[model samples]
Target: MSRVEARPIAEILAEVANAVPDEVIGVEFERARRRGAEVWVYQLKIIAKDGRLLKVEVDAATDRLLVAEED
Candidate 1:
């Protein structure tokens, strides 16, 4: 089996979703190459009750969730 990266993408997304007060609509893993490493980028779409979409990107290796511009 391949060695898992710094952290699991599912765990990272779960943590971020739990931290958010809004409701999560969708979660997807994006394949991208970063810093010579094949990194998994998690795109989380949160649907607010007020009808707003919140998108965030979480790094699979670092589990760092970064809030992006609202959509």
Candidate 2:
């Protein structure tokens, strides 16, 4: 099924890149089942400047950050 997004995936990636200023290695689009509705989310895998790997998810509709994890 196709996912719905407020903006283009590139724009979402750009927003993430702007916040981290790191190398984005991988990106994935996810459809989350929420209250019987499918919500679009963008996952950004980044290589931090400090050499740590990070994962960030953003809400496609609101452009709000959902999660940010580093390893």
- Model 2 segments beyond 4 Å from truth? 1-4, 33-37
What lDDT score is found at residue 28 in candidate 1? 82
Per-residue lDDT of candidate 1, residues 1-71 (tens digit): 78656476567766876777778788788777767867778787888778889888777677776546588
User: Per-residue alpha-carbon lDDT of model 2 for 13-56, expressed as tens digits?
Assistant: 77776777999998888887655777888788889888999988
Please give the distance, in angstroms, between residue 36's alpha carbon in candidate 2 and its true position after superposition.
Answer: 7.9
Q: What value does the lDDT take at residue 36 in candidate 2? A: 79
- Candidate 1 residue 40 Cα shift, in angstroms, is 1.3
Q: Rate the local accuracy (lDDT) of all candidates.
A: 0.74, 0.80
